[model samples]
Structure formats: C-alpha cells, structure tokens
Target: MVPDDVVTYPTHWEADVVLRDGGTAHLRPILASDAEALQAFHVGQSERSTYFRFFAPLERLPDRDLAHFTQVDHQDRVALIAVAGEEGHEKIIAVGRYDRSGPGEAEVAFNVADDHHGRGLGSVLLEHLAAAARERGIRRFNAEVLPNNAAMIGVFREAGYVVRQHLDDGILAVSFDLDPTERSLAVMADREQ
Candidate 1:
C-alpha cells in the first residue's frame, strides 16, 4: 500500500504557465475533487475535439473513467490539469497525462479546450508532462494520434525530442526519446526567444 504522504495532490506539482496569447493558467496535479470540472470540460468540447482526444463519440465521462483519470498515483500514471478563471469560478481548460506502458516508456495524451486552442497551451502541457515523466525515470513518450489531428501532430513534431512516427491504418503512431537532440534543443531555444 502507498503511504498517505506519497501523493501530496495539487500542492506538490503546481505551477503557473503563461500562454503565447498573454493569458495565464494554473497548472497542477489533478485531484479527485475535480470530477465536476473535468466533466464540464468534456461537455464543453466540440465534437471534433472530442473525437481527436478519445477517438470516439463520448458524450460524457463515465464514473469509472472519472475515478481513473482524477485519482492518479502520480508515479506510474501522472496527469496535469490547466485551470483558468477566478478562484470561485475556475475551470479546467486542458489536460495532459502519461500512463506507463513499459520499462522506460509511457503513452502520452493531451486535450485542450476548444477556445484555448492556438494559444500554445498544448505545447506547454507537453513540455511539463515530458519533464514529469523524465523525473519518474521514463525515457520515452509514445502516442497514437489520428491522421487528421494535425494540431496535436504539430505539437509533438515541434517538441525537442527525437520523434519516430509510423502510419498504419488510420492512426499515426508517434514515439520520442526523452533525451533531447540538438535540433530539439534549438527548437526549444527558439521558442524562448
């Protein structure tokens, strides 16, 4: 059994991120209490956005999915949520997570609110998620994105990891080594400029 102190919840992995559009959001580990917010976030997504993330027509988040997504161990499975708005009316705008699939490797996924698209939130979330995965000794991140999800594909391509991609059927399987290559580093450096 894990100790009570093993997972400290939001405080242990919280940060403030500035978007490229000059807006800000609070980034923190997801909590069990976030079920309602997550549900609302799902409900607010456009049909195409939902399809890109879940690969199906999911109208609502099931109870089991809620429990599984919100209550993470933060070691083998880590999820970070991006929240915006005021204290009393905050909402979850984006989510990025990685689930360990093998030794030194994990499958990563991300979803950004429709209104928050094109603001660089996805890129920021991917960067943080990669860092968190590396902290847990993960050496690679993998994802199976739809062929039409160009925005997500772009984010992964722009990331500073050595990406390997394969196309089979209608899915694009993507993998990246955590160790940054020189080109990836230069891309990141340019982003900061």
Candidate 2:
C-alpha cells in the first residue's frame, strides 16, 4: 500500500509530440516504474553521448542512480521522458529535466537516444521542460555543456531565451532567462506549425 500524503503528479504533464522527421513520440513526466526503461535508454546511447551527459565514462546506471532519476517530486525536481513506438514496444528516446538550484533558477540537462539524434527531439523536449519550469516559478534555466557538443549549444542558441555563456576548464556554462524574446517566440510558433 502507498501512503496517502504521497502526491502523484497530474496527468496534464503528458503530451503527444511530433518530431521534426514526422515521427511521433509521447512526452510525459518520468514515473517510478520507468526505471528499467531509463536504464535501457542509457545503455543505448553512444560513448560520446554518454560522456557528454554524465561527464564521465559510465558503463551502466547503478541501482541508486536509477532510483534517483526515476523518482521525482515534480516541483523542485522534474523529469520528462520522450518515448517512441507502440505500447509494449515503447522505447525512451530522450529525457529532459531540471533541478531547482535556487529561487527562480534551475539547472537543466538532457539526453537523447543515439538513434534519435538530428531529429529535433532535444529542442522539443527543451521547450516542454522550459514550460514546466516556468509553471513552477523558475525564471532561469542553466546548463553546463562540453565545448565540443555543438548540437546542444545550438539548441540553446536558437531558443528564444536570452542565453549567456562562459567557458572554464573546458566546460561551457550556459544560462537562459525564461522571458522569451521575439526571436524565441517566433521559433516556438514555427515549431507549433
């Protein structure tokens, strides 16, 4: 049995998204039951993708790490998973999440499946994650990306938020204010079309 005080997040967070390549995916909040799927997704990533995400050579997600990533309160810490394929055959193609760092600010991260690269899934996931962050009163999203991850950098650069970057120790720190600029709004509008 479960405790009554444990709040389950609402289903409104779920969405159906169409990828840039005309493929479809279901985007929803990460659930505790998704631990195995998340692990499989991690294992499916390429070595470079894994390093860019975890900042180290991780052969597998340990039990503790899997639990931490799968369980979330959905307010201070939130994760959205993008799944592709049919019901039982579903696969986690990408994940985007944010951890509240301070009032009005949160640290963001994302990982896309190796096979799903260049399909605009990252941008789609980022947009949804930003919306969720704003709803939770977060005004800024921050991220640290390796200098060689041009794809990730481009996603942030093309987003409508005012993005600032600083490089130190081969890592690029990027920040985006939640206030959407005209360019950002236009880009989002185009995505909806």
Which structure among the candidates has the greatest TM-score? 2
Candidate 1 structure quality by residue, lDDT tens digits, 1-193: 2235445553646788778888899988877778899999999999999999999989999999988998898899999999998976999999999999999999999999999999888888888888888889999999999999999999998886778999978899999998878977786676566
Q: Note the Cα lDDT for every prediction shown.
A: 0.88, 0.89
Question: What TM-score do all the candidates reach, one by one?
Answer: 0.92, 0.95
Writing each residue's lDDT as its tens digit, candidate 2 over 47-106 gives: 999999999999899999999898889899999999988878888999999999999999
- Candidates in order: C-alpha RMSD to true structure: 2.9, 2.5
Error of 2 at 147 (Å): 0.3
lDDT winner: 2
TM-score of 1: 0.92
**lDDT value, residue 42 of candidate 2:** 95
**Candidate 1: worst 10 consecutive residues by lDDT?**
1-10
